[model samples]
Target: MTLFVVSIILSAAMLHAVWNAIVKTAADRTTMLGLVALGHVIPGAAMVVLLPLPAPESMPYVLASTLIHFGYFYMLGRAYAHGDLSVVYPIARGIVPALVALWAMIFAGEVLPLQAWGGIALIALGIQLSSWQALRSGVESGVGRAALGYAVGTGFCISAYSLTDGLGVRLSGNTLSYWAWGAFLHLFVAGFIGLRKRNTLAALRPRTWIIGIGGGLVSMTAYGLVLYAKNFAPLGAVSALRETSVIFAALIGFVFLKEGNWIRRLGAAVLMAGGVALIGTSL
Candidate 1:
């Protein structure tokens, strides 16, 4: 990938980490998630009015992505409830690069080089390293295992939606339009969750609403940048690079959430940085 594309993806990765941190720190994860989805819908509505519709061919992928994202939000909320940001975020995002690669190869017929595969492996390994302590200590317990399960499921959802939107944006002709429609479709997700958590929503303070919706806006921008980059780069490469958010999450967890050992996280960050270098050069 070009430096420009790489930079774009990295910016998105940072933003992604920020939003996930918001959710992880929130008092009510489910309600926060609903507001985040509502965040997408608010701007998406205006964008849909300003931008033209995506191609009909890509609409199916858009719908598929929306469904997958619902599963993603649910799994993410559950994962955070059970584990720390450093641990759950790594497990959730670490697997996406490899899974997206496999999906891209199988469905999109896009084969990556051996070096790229090496980079992906390093990234995945580094992610595990970030949570090595938690995994070792917590895996034997039921809650730990549950967190792991939910995190892995979140990874699957991410991979599914990444590939879907990657291909969808390519076919849409206008990346902004495709993204607007995709974001708009999250209205359903927000509505469903809102209805289920009506009392919670009603009870939330103004500060919580501001934070939740702001997080949603950040999430929307992060994914939009990724979708735009996909039009110019390989899906697997973009996915791998975007997942650098895991490293950012580790730092955020250590510094802000008071989770995990900083020494281990620093080592993991080095490994992930190396992985990014390899992927960037290979592409």
Candidate 2:
């Protein structure tokens, strides 16, 4: 990747970590998630009117991506409910790059070079390392097992949408239009979650709205950048670079969520940075 692309992807990574932290801290994750989806719709509804419709060729990918994202949000909410942010975030985000790379090669015909593969492995290893101490700290087997299962499911959903949007944006001919449409589609996810949490919505306070909506905007911008970068770089490489967000999430968990074992996490961050460097140099 060029410096410009790398910078955009890194910024996206930070924003993504921040939003996940916001969700991780919420008392009612499903309700908070619905509000976040509403945040996307609020802005997206306006943009859809202003922006031109995406190409017909891109609509299928957009619809596919939207459906996958619904599953992503559902699984993510469940994962957070069952595990710590540090543990859940790493496993969920860590596995996506490799999966995206594999799918991109198999389905998208995007072949990565050797160094890029090395970088992906290093980043994946670092991500797993970041969560090692916590996973080994003797949490209950039942909760731990459930969290792992949910986290892995969330990872698969992420990879599904990552590839879907990456190709969708490319086919759309206009990144902004594609992004707006994708955001607008979030209404379906919001409505689904909202119906499930209908009894809880009226009770949500202003603070919850602010956090959820604000985080949603950030989340939208972060993924928007990723979609844009996908237009210029290999999907797998871009996805691997984006996994650096795991480092940010670990720090966020340590500082804000009062999660412990900073030394190991910091070490993991270094490995992630090294992996990023390898990928950047290869580009």
Candidate 3:
């Protein structure tokens, strides 16, 4: 990957971490997530009006990606409800690069070099290190196995959509159009979640709307950058770099939410940064 592409992906990673932190600190995760979806819809709706449609070939991938994202959002909300940002975020984000690498190799025909694979492994290891305490003590600490299961499921959904969008954007012939349409699909996810929490909608405060919509916009921009990066880089390599957001999310949790063990988490973040640097060199 070029430095330009790597920088774009890293920026997206940071933004991704920020939005997740917003959701992590929210009082109502599901409702807040719905609002985030609204965030996506607002910009997406505007882009749809301004940009031309993606190729028909890309539509199937877009639909598939949207469906996978619904599952991702559902599992993410459930994971947060059952666990801390430090624990759930690491496991969910850590598992995706490997899965995406596998899928990219099989479907996208993108085979990475040994050094790149090593970098990816190191990144995943660093992510696990960030949550080592939580995983070791999760059961005794009452974090529960269910939360872990949900997080892993969320990871699967992430890999599914990452590959879907990676391919979809390449096929679309217009990165902006693909991203805009993908953002618009968030409306469906928000609508589905809103229907389930219909009673809460009337009671939501302005603060809630601001946080949720703002988070959605951040999340949309983050992933939009990733989609654009995929056009220039190998999917697996890009996915590995993007998972650095796990480290960012860890820091965000510690600083913003007052989560514990900052020293160790920061150390893990350093390790992840090193891993990203290795990947950059490999490229």
Candidate 4:
């Protein structure tokens, strides 16, 4: 990958970790989700208008992306209910690049040299090893136990969106438009579901608004950067690099949240670095 693309991926990784940390602290799911939607909705709407509309051929991919993202939001909510940012985010974000590699090979017809496969394995293994800490720590915190199942599910959902969005943007010939539309439609689904219930709409706290808007902006920026980086670099490389958000999330959890153990954090860091090294060897 080019230096520019790597830099973009790293920037996106940082933003992605930061916003996810914000989300994990949210107390009200409905309001938080809605406010997050609002944040994306503004940027998404603006981007949609700024860019040319997608070709009709790309609409199917866009719709599929929207559905997949709904699942992403739903599963994210469920995972947050069970775990901390350190545990759940790493597990969820860590799983997708490997799966995306397989998906790309089979469905997208993207090829990886043998070294790439080995690198992917290290990425997967690092994610798995990091998760062991969560399994043990979660029991005591009671925060991460339920997140195990939900976080796993969220991983699949994220892969769906990642691959689908990658394909859609590549096909549409407009990555910006594809991502903006996906973001808007995604927020639409989350917003509708949140508003459907009884009193969920009545209560909206200031923190929710602040965090949600900030998260939405950061999240949208991160996705935009990812889409751009994917276009310029190999999909697997982009995905693998992006998953380093787990490392960032772990650090944020430790420094800001002060809930993480040093040993587990170190392990997570080493595994993530190993994954990056393995990925670099392939290149």
Worst lDDT 10-window in candidate 3: 251-260
Determine which window of 10 residues in candidate 2 has minimal summed lDDT: 134-143
Cα-based lDDT at residue 61, candidate 1: 92
Residue-level error in angstroms, candidate 2, position 188: 0.7
Model 1 RMSD in angstroms: 1.7
Per-model TM values vs. the true structure? 0.94, 0.94, 0.95, 0.87
- Considering only N, C-alpha and C atoms within 3 Å, which residue pairs clash in candidate 1? 1-283
> Any idea how many clashes model 2 has?
0
Candidate 4 lDDT over residue span 1-283, tens digit each: 5667777888898998888777767776556657667788888888888889877687799999888877887888788777765567667877888878878888888888877667666766665565567755776766644688889899999888888877877887787788788777766765686667437655666766677888878888998899887776667777888888777876887788885576866786787777676666566
**Model 1 spans > 4 angstroms off:** 77-87, 144-146
Q: What is the Å distance of residue 9 in model 2 from its true position?
A: 0.3
* Cα shift from native, residue 272, model 4 (Å): 1.6
Q: Write one digit per residue (lDDT tens) for candidate 3, span 76-159.
A: 888978987667877898999999999999998999888888889989998998878877777678888889999999999999
As for model 4, its CA RMSD to the true structure in angstroms is: 2.8
Of the two candidates 1 and 4, the one with more favorable lDDT, higher being better, is 1
lDDT of each: 0.89, 0.88, 0.89, 0.76
lDDT tens string, model 2, 1-283?
8989999999999999898788878888778888888888888999989999989899999999998987887787788778866667778888999999999999999998899889999999988888887666526444577788889999999999999999999999999999999999999989998898988988888888899999999999998899999999999999998998888888888897788689988889888888888888887
